[model samples]
Target: MRDIHIQAIRVHQYGGPGELKLEEIPPPVAGPGQVLINITATGVNPVDWKMREGMLARPLPFIPGVEASGVVIALGEGVTHLKVGQAVYGSVDGSYTACAAADASRIFPKPVHLSFEQAAAAGGAKIAWSALFEEGRLTKGQRVLIHAGAGGVGHLAVQLAYHAGAYVIATAGEENIDFVASLGADEVIDYKAAPFETQTGQADLILDTVGGDTLERSYQLVKSGGTLVSIAGKPDEAKAAAAGIRAVWSGAKSVRAMQEVARLLDRGLITPAVRKVFAPLSAAAAAQEYSRLGGPGRGKVVLLIE
Candidate 1:
């Protein structure tokens, strides 16, 4: 049989957006317990640029993209829950292509109400869910602070925390305070207006999406016995111990988390905000650059494959 080739964005040598090259490559096959998907859209994430810039190393000449939304075209052996032609969305390796094969366990049925772009953007919800509930152990009536509340993960985290009955306090710039509040935040602190530590009260949990100084400042904000969860990097154990608080690093990609997020989406309980859309695969580099510069908050950047 003749091999089928698809146009994809490839990074041969890590450097910058320039490394993202559109090329003709053989499409990945659906291996055991995998599903071949015709990718409709891909979510642009910081990891995409980090991998391209060598911060996160991968094999040379590999495709870049972690999550996407698309239709299943073929199913690998032993996969029974999904069928070909089913619309699904999930984390997939090399999603910056027209077609990519994903592990069957990771992908879930796309919510019917969401556009392909919206589904792609919601990929960050898994991280948000894990951070807010799994790592932070947030509970109803407890105070939870979400840093960067208008960001891709933060926005979702804010809504999830709020709907779960937690007192959701969020940090954002002056521009996004209202936007974050609209998403169910009980309070939105304009971080630029004042030091967040000074403006916010002690919280039962803090979800740190912005690391470095933000994470450093959050230790004092959490009440004793409270938890601080960071997705950007590992939290300092000594600082956490000294503060009498629990600190956790959240980066787990759980299928169960994704499934729960999907249910939320289908029920209109949580909405994914897509900030920008670039098309035709060739725009992968530009999309990454946009995301790197922090494309409009309260959403994610998406790449629409032609």
Candidate 2:
């Protein structure tokens, strides 16, 4: 019941980047099992823009942001794992703000070696890891292909797949072939230059981030009994059944998945790639730019609070 105010970006009506408005709102209070975070940096996801434009299903007048890095300012009753002043980062409530209140379960200690920008990028890395390793059931010695190899999730997925002892293949623009290769991709296919299905076939697992035609093409590359996991599109179950392959669609908002990501990051086994940083007030403009420059090696776009 303390009086505090913080700057935030809010969307009253869903539309394009121009819809986002920056204004002052009451600083969030730590509720039961929640922690108040003083956000330092927030990551911009494609979903954030989609959510803002009413593309993804959500309530109106919502604060839009998913991943962020910050310090804990307060803890709710029954919270014990975190303390005030601890540097932490995660995808939490309305991340486009100077302060936030998030479930304690979703927060994790920021990696000691990562900067605030890097931590903001790490948010997508965790999701990629969970969708690929945990849900996709990726195994060592398997052949894996990741679409958009230089994207926020794709780059990390490439590294994680390679680190897991998989023969990793990645699809990106010709310009990003070397970047994906440096992340340990055994082969890099230029999706723009050639059809991925024609270049790489019989993948044991496929991590599909780009939906529609990309998803349809991915199904052709997975071997029988293989799994195809998508974060952006719903898997065509009928198509999978016909091809004798398994398909999974990932939904965000899993606490367990977030914790798993934090562990991997803390161990320094995986890292996020950050391409640019924008001030919080400029998040809308940044999102427009990110959408325009869609490709590999562009990395994650982040909004800095301070």
Candidate 3:
């Protein structure tokens, strides 16, 4: 273990945004099959706040972020694929801090083209790609409708489906309709102005990044034998059976899923749109932004750590 400490946001209790508190904590040791990292940046997702709110239960007082970009500082026993001083990005333990220890297989090389802030947002892209292709089984020449098309995951989903030769339709706020269109969405629907189901009737696939009523309504938009994959919440199986479709709730829970997205990112085929970046000390402000706008803002919220 290193005789050093790092600053990170820690939650001692489950509540709202105010629960996230900045603290000075000891640096973590890399366990076997893990690599220690000096975190450069962290991407804030719905999971972060959700976990803080006790929606996802974890042991209290742990640093919150998981999706991060950083440099390898140390390696654990039996780890061989990566070496010291290499730049990598992936889901890591207590990633809101200045240092982290992450799974070796799950961490990926930071693309030369993207800044650490951009690379840290890779988890969102990977989740979208996994939900659309791996779990949703999106195929070419089919119609895919993405809810919250301008969100952290939804934006990437739109691009991936479009590039995969799917006829892409996306629903967004009226303010982001053109932005979603710029990402190659063939059709854009303003969910506030109209019902998305009316515009996109019976799509082959529907990616639900917005849960609650969105998931419920999406069951109606999928054609028979189609699939509805969700990242926000688990879809209702009875509803899926009633609609003659499959409702899946799974995404990039593994590093291999992130590596696939890294390849696309390195090749410049896809990118994460970062909406706002907060300084390390401004974690509270970042949490407030996420709560005010939710995680589906036009892009993602990131924390810049020096």
Candidate 4:
């Protein structure tokens, strides 16, 4: 026990960003198989805002972030893979605080070439990798369509699929067409210009980060025997069955895939595009809101705790 308190943004009640309150709280201790971190930065994802809105239920007064980058401050009993003072990045349950404890396996050594902000920003790569490879089973030479190509996860999905030899087609607003294209997308369709289904031909796989109508429309674009994977929500199974394709909702966390993503990032084969970084931790509300609206900027939004 450190016998010290830290500032954190907690959600005492489920509502909107207004419910995210910054308050002083006791720093959490590392349990066995866990590591305590002095969080320097956190990645803002839709899941954070969704959890704030009560879409994902948790105990009251819990901190509200899932991905973070920081230095290891303490190691739990039996933990030896990582040493104190080493920088790392990984999935965290409550990252919206000055310090947090994470599963030892979840945290990976931060790449020497990556800043804490970049490491935090790159946390979404795990989700992207899981959706594209593990769930969607994307392979080389296959046509894959990814929605919201400029988003936190979508941008990374685009690059990963493209580099994997998949013919990458991504849907973005006109302003982001060139930006998504630069991320290795073979084609960037301006969704505002028209319905993406019409602009994009049939695909072997479709990764939907933007759900609802976009997901509903994507069913028709997957060829027979193709797969549609959604991290946003559950796809309509009836529609998928009728279309003769597979529709799956992916929420599973892949630690192995995250390790591979870290390797790719370290080698410079892929990179995170951090669009905006908010400072002082109090800016978490604004950062979450910016991520929710898919702000004027492209790629990930970050909250710099320092």
Candidate 5:
């Protein structure tokens, strides 16, 4: 048997980013339906911090990180389509590490023209696209409102909706209006200056990424019989029934959805924005700063593994 050593960030107890411990461990092996990847870059999402703090439900002794881009090094039995040395991107367990063993179903071949950083950003954007375009059934020419338009998911949602022929309205902090607009949003509202519900009246679809009041307010902005799809919060089913609107909380993790994202990425219809890059050793500090910033841009904070 061959042995390899790789570095990963692990958390024994959940709290703040300060709790992350960097350690070296044996490189992961591919199991049935799995593939080992030499991770080049990993995209950091809000969920990483949430999971780290135990706010999200996950098993303990967790290795945090969601999205990554890398090259396939090994494949498990039954995995015949993907070959070693092929560039691929996907969501995986413990993406912060130098090497990751991911379910082959969650992986996709990376676009030849895209850099590793861009592919990393695509990981989170693809989930957003699946939620808004696939499950939400967003249509062209309809008015769609996306919360946090400059965010990893929101930015892509804006572009996808625009490409789909929707009149895209997006909300973001004042500093991000231009960035959101550049992503093809028709109207950019400053979320702090005025509530999104107040700025954009009834819409055909409302994509909510911020929960709590933001999620609640979204209901009021959707026209009667309109749909409110949330990736961050659970909608009020009772309220939706009363208002004649459909509300749902959607998550994207299926193999098919990941493949769809890969297709879009390969076509250059969508791209990931990278905001910052940090060494694997600085992952804890990066997480701390990310949480502090509240995740500002569509740009992804990445840990460069290689």
Candidate 6:
């Protein structure tokens, strides 16, 4: 076995961004149906912060990131589909490191047009597709409402909904209203000035990226036979039935879905809203943490892991 010590971040106990620390750790090895990737870029998403904040179910003593773009360095048994040295991007366990061992199924070919940072940005966008098309059953010519339109998921959802022929409506702070509109939203709401539910009457589909009261209020915006999907909070089934709409909490860990996103990237049907990249794990983690808490919360915060 090759001895590999890599720079990585680990959370021993969840608390805050201050708890995230960089250390030298053994690089993950490819197991069955897995491939070892030499990570080039790592995406810092809300989930990373959420996981650190104890919002996720994953327990302590786990590596911190999930989205990365990298080159395949090794393949374990039954991983004949991809060759070593192929550039790939996808979601994986413990991706906040110089190398990651990921299930081969989740990895997808990186489109030639996308840089490593761009590919890393697609992680959240891919999950947004699953929420809108796969779970929400969004259709063309429908009215689609996407909350937090400038967010990692919402911006992509806006573009996806727009390209699908839906009338896209988005909510964002005043600063990002134009940014969201540029991403193809038919209408942009200044969510700070007014409540989104009061502005949008009804929608065929609703992607709720904002949870809490925003998620609860979304039930009113969904059309009679439409669906509201969220990656945030779980919905009350009884309330959904009463409102005559389907409420689903959706997520993606799908190979086919990642492939679909990759295809879209190749064709230029959708573009990721990537604003910045930080070099090194410690600085990247801190920058992402600051952005998640108080900085401009639009686009993706990526870590250049090389």
RMSD of 3: 2.1
Predicted candidate 1 versus true structure: per-residue lDDT over 1-306, tens digit per residue: 987799999999989788999999977889999999999999999999999999987989899999999999999999999999999999999999999999999998887899999999998789999888888878899999999998989999998998899999999998898999999999999998899999979999999999999999999999999999999878999989999999999998777888889889889999988888999799998999999998665589999997
- Prediction-by-prediction clash tally: 1, 1, 0, 0, 0, 0
- The top-ranked prediction according to TM-score is 1
lDDT of 2 by residue, 1-306 (tens): 866678888989988778888888987899999999999998888888888878888887888888789999999999999999999998786888889999888889888899998998887777787788777889999999899898888988898898889999999888888988988999999998878888876898999989899998888889999999998899999999899999989865467777777777888888788877777555655654575456334579888987
Candidate 5's displacement at residue 130, Å, is 2.6
TM-score of each: 0.97, 0.94, 0.94, 0.97, 0.94, 0.94
Off by over 4 Å in 5: 1-3
Q: What RMSD does model 6 have?
A: 1.9
Tens digit of lDDT per residue, candidate 5, span 213-287? 899878878899999999999999999989899898988766676776777777988777776767765555575
Q: Write the per-residue lDDT of candidate 3 for residues 1-306, one digit (tens) a residue.
A: 756677777889998778878787877889999999988888877777778888889998767887889899999999998889999888786787888888888888888888898888767778888888889898999999999899888888898998899999999998899999999999999999877777766799999999898888888889999999998889989879988999989856655667778789989899888877887654644654564566545777888877
Which scores better on TM-score, 2 or 5?
A: 2
> Model 4, range 47-127, lDDT digits (tens) per residue?
899889988888897899999999999999889999999999998989999999999999989989888988998876788
Indicate whether candidate 1 or candidate 6 has the larger lDDT.
1
Reference-based lDDT, each prediction: 0.91, 0.85, 0.84, 0.91, 0.82, 0.85
Candidate 1 backbone collisions, by pair: 150-298
**Clash pairs of candidate 5?**
none
Ten-residue region with minimum lDDT total, candidate 3: 282-291
Candidate 4 — which residues are off by over 4 angstroms? 1-3
Q: What's the CA error at residue 164 for candidate 6, in Å?
A: 1.2
Report the C-alpha lDDT of model 6 over 255-302, residue by residue, as the tens digit: 667787778888988888776778877775675665577467578888
Q: Could you tell me the TM-score of candidate 6?
A: 0.94
